[model samples]
Target chain A: MVVASRKAAYHHKDGEMTETLVKKNMSASRTSAVPNYRGQQVELGRETVGNVRCANPFMVAENVNVFYGDNHAIKDVTLEIGKKEVIALIGPSGCGKSTFLRCLNRMNDSIESARVTGNISLDGGDIYDKTLDPVVLRARVGMVFQKPNPFPKSIYDNVAYGPRIHGLAGDRAELDDIVHRSLERAGLLKEVKDRLDDPGTSLSGGQQQRLCIARTIAVNPEVILMDEPCSALDPIATARIEDLMDELCEDYAIVIVTHSMQQAARVSRRVAYFHLGYLVEVDDTDKVFTNPHHKLTEDYITGRIG
Target chain B: MPNQMTSRARVEAGLSRRKRKEKIFRASGLLATAIGILFLGIFFSTLVAKGASAFVQTYLLLDVELTAETIAPGGELDLEYADFDGLVRTALRNNFPELSGRNDRRELNRLLSVGAGFQVRDLVVANPDLIGTTQEIWVPAASNVDMLMKGNIDATVDESLRNLSDRQIRWIDTLDQAGRVDLRLNKALFTNGDSREPELAGIRGAMMGSFFMLVVTIALAFPVGVAAAIYLEEFAPKNRWSDLVEVNINNLAAVPSIVFGLLGLAVFINWMGLPRSAPLVGGLVLALLTLPVIIIASRAAIKAVPPSIREAALGLGASKMQVVFHHVMPLAMPGMLTGAIIGMSRALGESAPLLMIGMIAFIVDVPGGFTDPATALPVQIYLWADSPERAFAERTSAAIIVLLAFLLLMNLAAVILRRRMERRW
Candidate 1:
């Protein structure tokens, strides 16, 4: 039965490839169309791939299904997250994009009657391991929220919060250094250094968003998952964060879930487009934006549908 | 266009009705304000007319020689002793040197207070050097003299019941003319502790007792009430047990304060055999009465804390406990303190429960500790107000003033704390 299921998964992949070819040719406009490459190999040979490797290709998804009371939120969808890459999960409202993000760090556990199923693993390592503390796992995989939420505490404390929780600093001086470096990486240190003790909430919306990024980076997570982190900020804050993401790629694998197609194009090296709990297409960011392979992906990239 | 015109007419009709209703409401509000002001005016005037004369006390000062031979006439024996009454009478007679052959001195002696002797004895013992020395002592006059000083005495009374003889009355007249016998304002009437003598009794002890009791109430109730509120409002599940607990808390708040006093009588005093009339027992009872009020108010305050703050804390990797204690508690503090102050103020004015548990009048010395027998301000007022002695009327009024002052202080504290903790969001 296991072998049969494995074979079925491969067949599903082949069928998806054929659908990609059909979608690219059928698109009315390139603006709305993700150009589908039929039989065109994505040569992730030398330059595209990196030194980082995932321990296992087979992502074990155990009984993972979500429900909001009688309403079935996310179906029993299973997928693997590969190392040294980006995976963007997209869906319309109530399709469970945020729910899935919460499940990654057991953030869903806080919500009442919001049940989750299926065990998602990173390199076959049980993320929901019995001995694994959620706080520790959260430290390993940091998340950036949709809204810019900074503590009423000082700007320095806002960035240093995660580091303090994880005991990442040797002393006050070291913690201060970490806060400085993280803020610098987020492109906010220069603007806020003179008033380090000023409340983080006192900053502009864009600065607050950058402060949140600086906070996430202070803990030094292996994977950074952003959930529409730029949605609440102005276009300038959004652009600055996108540029920060480009700079972050060398040190950590970044997975960003964004509503803006232009933002995905500007920031991500690679992009995986999702539609209704299915990975429609995965390719270079430029190709996915200028030319999508799936019908839904193309429709979404343009103004046709989301 | 016809439908639009009809809809506009309907809107106009609704607006006209609303305006008419507003007029009626304003008229009724004015009536209510007049009624409220009338009631307050009546209350103030009634209290002033009935209570004003109680502030002044009639006193007699005389040079009483404290000779050990006269005090201990028979000399030393078994227990310690002093003839304080003999000393007081001799001092009064000595002050009136012309009363040697007259029987008016006996009737005139009745004008002195019962505790006047105790006052002289205490003074002599305190300053032993005055044992053989002549000391001018000031002591409260009798209740009759107090009435006479306040002009409450009727000169046309029936001869059979008229206690003061014409000669003694003449001496009183002479004293009055000399300005040695006059009604002076008594500061200690509101500031001193209770004593057996009506003249010596004051609300100060009961005030301290109530103050200390309220301190204990705030210390115990604030933390427990806020913790319970936080747990119930923020973290506890909406199961049957928690729901039942919530219901019980509401019901407990409505239970009569006397019921809690009874509980204290049984559990704290009888069962535990704690000292009766102690402020600790009284405080514990009042705390029980105030706890439910505090819990309900704190829960409302905690509920008023926006969920966004909790989300913000949780998203920052703070645990569930941290989210509440750090963010939620600080935001809810001002409201909690206000609730606590109000609850404590309510507890202070309560008399029935304190009366039920022997807090009526532990009249002696001031309370030295929690275990010491003490009366609360309201309880002292109740005792004085119930006394048959007409002189106690003034003391009762004075007690009410003290109680009112304390309530004002607590309310002021609530306002200041509420303002201090006010936040923008």
Candidate 2:
């Protein structure tokens, strides 16, 4: 009966199941005669709910785990990021969401004691292959930090930093064009075009964050990873960045780690919820919010547990 | 309410006691500062009072007949073998025609400096026509006469106690009355080299030695120190070996500089077979002493650069080398330069290491190259201070003043460079 009920809820398709309905379903499963759901015995944190695979995946991780000197930072996890899609990884603090995000671009290699096991691939290429340089990989998968860190250089140089380093531009005019287009796409050209010579640090916090975004996009990476890019911004700036993610997703896959559920709901097509280093559930944004299949995902979304 | 009132009164009492304690602490700090300033003021005042006399030297004008027979005896205009001292003696005897006895004539001739002959030679060499005519020449007086004229010697004291005898004082008075005695700027103090006669001794030789050593020291230490700091801070693995190196570097910074002097003596002088008393050897020794300081300071400067900058560069696909050279290095350069300047200044004031490398030897000629034999300013000052001559005491203070000035200028440059670099950022 519980399996049938969960199957019914999974195929509900309404996309607007009320919080009471999710709670009623959870309570009914607890009291039901059948002790199984989805043809398996139910467990809160052991198994992930919903689908982990995507229709057209480009970046894939399989049973990936991360350890920092024997401290399990990220547990056995699997997820796929597709081309031209926005995926949000959301969890409470210390849940390893950011760690998992770093794993995609092999950024975890910088940490001395961090050890990653299992497989992660981008476009069927093993990124951890000894022959593949991390420098080249980072150019393909760029990251925006939680804080805006513009170089101690002019706005133009900050935007030109990636292109110059990667030899992406062949000449001065080409570099200038790249910088101009990046700033324009980041929605900062009108504000900073007249003062490209000004130090990037001289900008307002929101503008500096936008300048960092411009810097990231100047390299034209295949995927852009943003780790709580809006956490340091005010609500208006956060809205601006959320709108930018919407527009940016059309050209490249974007993975965002955020603490704001509303942000995940607004920006991402799919939402992955992590709890205690475990990815509890990943599903379509509406399903994860309105009709979560896992008890922990439902409880977390309903403010019952973090 | 009664309990609350007591508690408030107790709090007020404790606050008054804390304020009293703070006042006492502040007064103590002020007192310490005042004491330090007082000592510094006394030191500078004494230095100026003693060293000011060295800037001006006493000269005696003499009408000397530079006979061609005495200067170019063979009519070949020979300058090196000229009897310049005989010409000076004849001029002195002409001035005092009354002194006929051999002892009286000898005492009168002693009034002129031994360098007076060299001065006359230089004048004649510059103007060959002066060799045949009698001309009025202003010659530096002997150190004793200079001391008496500068009031360093007490004429009121008995002849036995004074540096200048009664007869010499009388002669100087007669010259003063005739308007032949004058005080002029001591150009010799800057132009000439060390001499047995105090009036001929100058600091140019030691100054050149110090300059050459400092040049070599900074050239060797700055690049090596900065490179080591970069590697240890940016690329070195955090393991047992790196940890040991870090500890050893910290220890090396605290090592007494004299130990480095000993090491330089054993290595550069004994094993390497480099010439002793050469500025090159002194510079090598000082570089050893300064390297630890520069490395430690450079590491601190490199560490002070925010990690976010490194990450920003790294995130942009910059290689580790590119990140360090293009980003981290530029951001850390101002700090590194400041550290290097400070290290160079410390090396400048360092005399202990140079002393062990035989730089304490009394060198007479200014160093023209790194390998030439030389002495440093501090060693010259030390030698002068140990001299019995009253004039050397003044020169010692003057050398100290020059050293202090250079130190002040270097520190000022460091401050200005730091301010400018920080503003650029």
Candidate 3:
């Protein structure tokens, strides 16, 4: 009885930390949401959207909702993914974390039954706009799936597929360079450089995941969406990928979906907790893990509910 | 441990029971094999017994004096003296001298193939140098003579009932003794092409026509079918209309090939005014027949390519068109080709529809274009099978053998291509 009670007490203490964290992050965002009249007044003469601090907030999703047939897969969720920040979405299965991640690059548009509403913008331009080509949007907003889905092609060809398709490289030599650089960034070049002609599937599961990441990076996307990218990996591989994610955050804005609470806290600069297709709370990673406002977020973080 | 032991015992018991069942199954399998072999044995024996004699042919060797007086007037190579029937009669009289005194020379002439004149004409044309030179020519005899050589005819039958007289039989016997009658195997029967003369007709022209038709079929059906399949399977919106189209495509594959032939006749022949008896028309009809097969196969192949591939391509920023053509098309090509060849093989053997579209025409020259007059092997077989001549029976069987050989070759090529090219993800 004492052990069970002690476990409950530990859960409760964790809950209090999450609550305080949510309050602080939301407060800072609330102030930033308002018009910057004080900055305009301080300006010498010229003022424009560029002069504003929020001019290029990396990614801004406003009232995003997704439906698949009759099921409401995602509710109206509003969030801002700041430049070079690692934002992790933590949720139980089918809670729309992956759905929301796909919406970042309009990947859901490929699904015939899926219908997305509202604006999801990368650097202020609406990504879901009628004029925007999904192909170009996807090139700029790269994605990595849950499973290590390296194409049944050579490692070099796998990484080069994106650059070749988008005509990102100037020539074959340039494409080879892009492939090498991308693989190096993904931390797989050293291991696979000698066997570049080998099939992508010939690699280990963790290596295949990194290969997929390299393939995504070949297009030089400004943002990366990782949907449980490290789930189909071992502890060693997972740790390596997490470290890579931290380094990737310096150059590209990243949104990751993870089931592991520790992974969410360790990797992400900011964390969003989702429950039943709703974004329950969003805050800085440390604060969200330490203190949350929403009761559901508290329950999930403390292992009381999911 | 208890559960493991219990499971192990159960597995052993199950294995014993399975062993017993397998024994029974093997016994029944052997019985089925025996039955199959028995049936096959009967079928093959019947076929060989009935068709074996058809392979052998009889030839009449005649030592004729090729005098310039008979062949050409004024000792010149006159094309006018190339009267085929006159030359054949002169040769026949030279072989059987007893027939020279016979009153019923017309009856004696009937023993020789009515179309023997054509063979003689061909020989003269081929060797205009052979004029005025005495040569022993071994020419094909009539089918009745072939049957006689094979011992299928008896001489001791009733005088009134028999077509040939005892004296004519004596003449044939004397000619056989004098080495003037040559009853050798006829290889020309299989290698030659269609002719009005039953003795000289072969399936060569029809075989080439079928090949050309199948070529056109592959060229036409493969691209259109696979493209349509890719659009339907990968790119097209999955709405009610596409669903309806999918269902309709499935139904079209099941529709009788004859119906497609009728449709081709109406649309390709009457409506488009395509040349009748041309391989082009035949090919078009066959392609229409083959299209649905190829489409269904290609769709299945495209579907067999896992959705993960499409997602991966899309994730990599490849457009929908690129995803289909670059990845899906290569994967689906083998199945499409296999299906196309199978469909074309079926088309090769199709006769009823080709007959309705005037593919049964007795053509001698090889087809030059899609619009050229031609007959397919099966259509040639059909035409020969319908003829009242006794000799046409063997010709029809020979045509079937050729058609079967072509179909087998096509199927083998399909198998080889599929094995070599088809890649499993």
Candidate 4:
């Protein structure tokens, strides 16, 4: 019991050092929230918009910011994602929700003008460390985009893409099993089992999105990030995807960005709300919908302001 | 009621005017398309009418007895030493029994082709038993007689300006009346070499030269252009240096083709010391001329591939190289090939650059290799077009038709490939 208590003390001390570091890095503009806070400057103690830590996190983003040339796209954002949980990021348009989601796997590296600056770690390893490669990092943390961008290939090939590139399968038979298992887990086996050779694009929109989900999990990533996976989909398709996400969170840590307030409450245990480029609030899904702590979060969930 | 009627009449008048304008616009569009088709039809028909005669040429029939005296000097059949030209003159003399003056004999000899002797000689050599017998065979008529037999040279024209003399025309008429003159398909037009005699010239050498040059040009341009396009479009940063490259590439496309010729002359000829009229140098020059065109086209093709595909590949943990090669390039391939076809056709039609590279040498033999002395079809037509012979004009039009056919075939391939490979999504 002494060793455990002392270890907790050491963790708190480390947390204090990180808090001081966060204070030191905050520019003058980030010290206070906007005047919608009744013209009162909120205290900057430990400087968090919401509950930003957990007992053991699968991924941690500390004091992260993103810029595009002169545009500060994301500002001083800090969040931690726990394993076996579905966390939904919710916000108005252009509030850097998708930007932060991409930061998890370094998908922003492909954008020419995007510049991300912060401490981001997966399983306590710095993802931005010069020794780490983004390609391998991405295998550990997969992503699903807004559209069902199934590759211009067969459904089998689409699911097998990650396996082929990383050499996860030793032979064609093994590869087929991974594809079949991934499709089964994505809840698409009943429909697509008979025509695995058909193009992924030949399926309906919902089927195509499920194919993308199957492709992502086939790589066996520890965490999955979906960027508004249901925006282009209909109501029925969106509900199906939400159901898939709930089932998937049993095995993998899931972070999803969505515009719908009800989708966050329905699918995720925790919700993160962003305003402009600022991350405003993060709390339990019930607490955020009923008793948001920040004024911007209240204004947004109440439908008064964004 | 009167005011309502006036307003209704005005609105109806306005509506009728707009509808009439729409119909006029549609009719004008149809008329413009018809005019373009009419011009194409007129051009094609004119070319066919002018060049169809060149496929067949006039020939003269003569009877000759190959005596042992002419075939052999010492009673032994010596085929190599035979006096075939003597036998030809003898046959003409025996047929007409004309005046024996040297001038008259020369005029009669001019009625037959210089190739007539070789025709009789080859026949006799092929069948040695016919040496002591008389046989009637048709050999090519002289170019002037050929023109007269084909009705290309008008007898109504003044005798001074016409290449054929009055007596030569009369002999041709007599031969025609006797059924001794015939128009056989001009196999020589395909089999022979470039000649001072337009009747003997053929495009085989030029066609072969063009084939070699085009092979070299495509081999050099297609890969280099695609690689450069991939580098510029996918990898190059948006900086001043990249901007300069982009500007220069666009500028190079508008640079006159003759400038590329001068560049080839300075670089490939003066500095490199390549053979002047060789298809190798001409092909290299053409490759340089087409590189800019291909690069511009390939860049557009690469650009036309959607960005969502790249994002999808990247989201799947694909490396940048995999994203480009596996997804982007396959999607963009059909467009790249279309661009390549357009650039190559442009190279095929280019004559000025090859001319500047010195492909204007008077070539005789078909190009046996890339480095041999050669001329392309356009250069051949250029050379033939400058000739004083009336027959070369027909050959010039024929070469144009052949060039158009080659371009048409490449365009058809581009269309077929696009249809086969194009994906709707």
Fnat scores for every prediction: 0.15, 0.61, 0.63, 0.59
Candidate 4 versus truth, CA RMSD in Å, comes to: 7.3
| Model 3 stretches astray by more than 4 angstroms | A1-56, A234-240, A288-295, A298-306, B1-56, B74-76, B83-92, B102-111, B114-117, B150-187, B362-366
Candidate 2 chain B, run of 10 with poorest lDDT? B416-425
Q: What ordering of candidates by lDDT runs from best to worst? A: 2, 4, 3, 1
lDDT (Cα, tens digit) per residue for candidate 2, span B72-125: 888757977788888888887887888899899889988999988889998998
TM-score of chain B of each: 0.87, 0.95, 0.87, 0.90
For residues A142-217, write the lDDT of model 3, one tens digit per residue. 9999998887789999999999989888998999899999999999999999999998989998998999999998
User: If ranked by TM-score, best first, what sequence of candidates would result?
Assistant: 2, 4, 3, 1
Superposition error at A266 for model 2 (Å): 1.8
- Report the C-alpha lDDT of model 1 over B193-242, residue by residue, as the tens digit: 88666777777788778877777777888788888898899889978999
lDDT of 4 at B389: 86
Cα-lDDT of candidate 3:
0.77
TM-score of each: 0.81, 0.91, 0.82, 0.89
Model 4 DockQ reads 0.52
Each prediction's number of clashing residue pairs: 11, 0, 9, 0
Candidate 3 chain A: 10-residue stretch with minimal lDDT: A43-52
lDDT of 2 at A236: 93
lDDT of 1: 0.73
Interface RMSD of 3: 1.3
- The candidate maximizing DockQ is 4
Residue A304 of model 1 has an lDDT of 36
Q: Write the per-residue lDDT of candidate 4 for residues B299-358, one digit (tens) a residue.
A: 998898888788777877889899889988888899888988898899888899988988
